[model samples]
Target: MISSLKRFLIGRPLKSTELGEQRLNKKKALAILSSDALSSVAYGPEQILIVLATVGAAAFWYSLPIALGVLILLIALILSYRQIIFAYPHGGGAYMVSKNNLGITPGLISGGSLLVDYILTVAVSVSAGTDAITSAFPALHAHNVMIAVFFVLFITLLNLRGLTESATILAYPVYLFVVALFILIGVGGYTILTGQVSPELHTPMGTTVTGLSLFLLLRAFASGSSALTGVEAISNAIPNFKEPAPNNAAKTLIAMGSLLGILFSGIILLAYFYGIAPSEEVTVVSQIAEGVFGRNYVYYFIQGTTALILILAANTGYSAFPLLAVNLAKDKFIPRMFTIRGDRLGYSNGIIILGFLSILLIIAFKGRTEQLIPLYAVGVFIPFTLSQTGMMVKWFRERPKGWLPKLLINSTGALISFSVTLIFFLTKFNQVWPVLIFIPIMITLFKKIRKHYDEIAEQLRISTCEEATPIQGNIIIIPIAGITRVVENSLNYAKSLSPQQIIAVHISFDKEEQKKLEEKWGQWQTGVRLVSLHSLHRSIIQPLTKFIDSIERRTTGSNYQVTVLIPEFIPKKGWHHILHNQSSFLIRTVLLHRKNVVVATVPYHLKK
Candidate 1:
């Protein structure tokens, strides 16, 4: 029944040959991989306002310059990652690039950073999506965390259904969001040109809390860099694209970057013209929609689509985290189960783990986007710097054609990424300090897991020069509680082994039971030795293991093997097994570590 339910939800298992058909085309690929980067425009401009809003209305205009700076850095990163795509089309993303060019430590650093970043991406995206929902209908504000968690679970199930299928389900909403934003931009632009609406009057946002300085502007830029977090996912998942994956992935990246730039810039400009300020309950995009279309259908249409796209944006993290985990698992950094594909050909373990982690963050922050944003950008930038640095080092070593231009592009990206990392540390040290501690701890854990796997392999390796030892004899020992049909089956199975001798050992907690069994055995005349021992403390495993130990110690010089046959009764129903004492299970569990001891189970299935 459980299997049937699972099959119904995730569909029947796909054949390995069907994997090629699961790869996505360019249009669908954009919706699958680029959703996080594109949907970020919903809250990117507002993050800048959050930081600049600290210094009063005068500092608000500075958001435009800071936004342009983030855009320039965005272009540099796109060019840098495109070089990565052409060079390593197999698609390990930053972790693969860093491990190859740099050493294992740097690679693990990149891998760990990315894993944490992907979890945060889901948390931030869904929380922001919840904000859009509540902004339109204020009554839902109290249930934001519950709403965010529902979307995470929903997206996780969709992803587990397979890549192409989820892409088809999600692609329409992304295009709807893009089309909706362009309409907002076009209509808003028209209103300004025709003087239907005048520039919004600016109000001072209370007294200046902090004096405006160069540091403050950089802080705002750092917050705005959240827009660039998911940009490298395209390069990381090159294998997920259709045939001619490199060309298709590169084109998708460019297309995604173009859309992201246009939408992001348009939102920022409109917010500025309309004098939109970041509100706790209402978002900047929500405010802009209200200003342009009022409370009409178009306004609600924009709100609904914005919420849908933002929630689905977590698909980017769902796609990339599992793919990255597969690479790490192959290298023995993480557990091997992450590499296993589910019934629908998705990495089910990684997807489920990502969902749980994102839900934890949503609940912890109470679905507040502002609180989560501080933890968001730093994880991605760490990988961004390392990946670009890895590429820069690769160019100098390989010196491929056009190495100089490639080197310049990656070098600039690396520098800008490193600068962003530094700014995040300097400015938001109070909030982001936990992430600084998390990366190194994760790297250490990766090394420890690798070391454990290496030690296990060495212990299991066979010796090629050693000769095999031959056994001279065998002894079969059966532990019996009473003379029942299960005991008879065990005795017959032991006889079939044709050992030198068979001994039935019983540890009796009561004297009357011990006598009754001996009398029955004598009357049956089984012609096997019956050894009875008294357990003062009624301990079963302790006395039985000791008797086996005495026999092995006595036959130390002889090449004799000892085998224990355990008799078990199989229940008719699944829950019926709980009614029995399970003595066979206890003996088997204790005897597994004994040297040169073989254990076998003789089962008698009950009809009723």
Candidate 2:
């Protein structure tokens, strides 16, 4: 059943020869790494408005402060993660950062938080994308779940085909989204600025003006910070960059930060100028698009294209999650399966697991981006908090000569990040704190389970001397067939056990081969005794059992323990079972039911 499920999930495994070498250049690497952050422009504004909806139109202005706050936090985090990439250009991101600076426990916390965040990233991005697309084509709104499932499967297949294939395909859509959005915002802003009569778009039908309070502002800020989700993905993916990994990663980080800042800021400004009101029902971005382009063909085209970009934003998690899992496995925080590369030299297991979990989340939340938004930021913030704290520790521990400047910078970044993390937790507690609490609990349990497994493994290990411990007995039974290499090797290995006496025992069914075997045994040395039992009825287990009983009865006065050394062969070809068979298995099963008998296998390697 497990094998069938595995086959179902990953499909057929490709051969190593079929995969070829991974040849991602710097440009391609940056594209693949930046896709998630770039895609955020689609939903970031929408999320900000969703937060402000609870407090009505007056609180909509608060989005500016909240967005600016998020921007400040983004800058600090980008700078801090830049230092991280410099320190760990080989990848591992939060896991490596916390593990190196704070210890394994903190590293595991970072790993768990990053894992949850990545999965959420995929689900939230894809769902929000689907919502955007549905907004343009109201007819398909009912089948949002189906569309989400299809995209998830499609992306999963693309990733499985290998990174380069997926990156090439995804790069164009990401570029189109960026260009279309910038064009719309630029044209819309110009039209509004030049005193051209633009459509006075009203708020969505159901929205009303409700008064705001302190708590509402905090929630709005927390929600707006979701735009900051994919900012750290590049830091985790630095190892995948071309040679001079640090420089390439730093450049990618700067580009991502600059692009995200402009795109995010432009969307917010455009939404505000166009009078895109807060809606508990409809996205402010969609409303802004409708107002700018109306319900005409061009507007629908922009909406559809924007939705596609948002959906592909989930691809960021696809690129980041596996790398995080690989790093966690390296730190022994996660299972070693995550570290095993597939034929394409990507972490296939981790990727598939991420895909499956993201699907579950998409289904659980019923594809509602607003509902999942709160849960989304919690995990991201936890890692952000720990990573910043870890960076502060790193800055102090390895203080360079001109250290005060660097320390102040890192400390300030750490302070901002950690403070936002605290606010997000406090404000989002009712909605998101459960996940924050749950993730750490899981991390602790996983660590305990791993420690327990390690202890059991240590206890079960066999030492060399145990293999050579002498068996005290008057009679030593060495089960043999003909004088084949398997039988000879078993005899030699059994001798290493240093039994008090040695006897070569055989059960013969055919008279002709029995006579030939007896003649061969006649040439053996004096120290060894030969014993043969007649099994004319052709039953191997019965004869062996009777002979062991006879030997035990005769040696009642001495310490008698029968040691059976069985020669076993393992096949080279997985499908060669019909050609060769093993008899030691049957013998071992029968001997296990007997008293004062022990069985050991002496493995024989077969020629290819």
How many residue pairs clash per model? 0, 0
lDDT of each: 0.89, 0.75
Model 1: per-residue Cα lDDT over 5-107, one tens digit each: 8888888899988999899999999997989998889988988998888877666767777889989999999999998999999999899999999999999
Off by over 4 Å in 2: 1-23, 197-210, 279-282, 460-467, 470-608
For this target, which candidate reaches the highest TM-score against the unseen true structure?
Answer: 1
Q: How far is candidate 2 from the true structure (C-alpha RMSD, Å)?
A: 7.7
TM-score of each: 0.94, 0.75
Q: What's the lDDT of the predicted structure labeled candidate 2?
A: 0.75
Candidate 2 minimal-lDDT segment of 10 residues = 199-208
Worst lDDT run of 10 residues, candidate 1, spans: 199-208
Model 1 misplaced regions, further than 4 Å: 200-210
Instruction: Flag clash pairs in model 2.
Output: none
Shift in Å, residue 190, candidate 2: 0.6
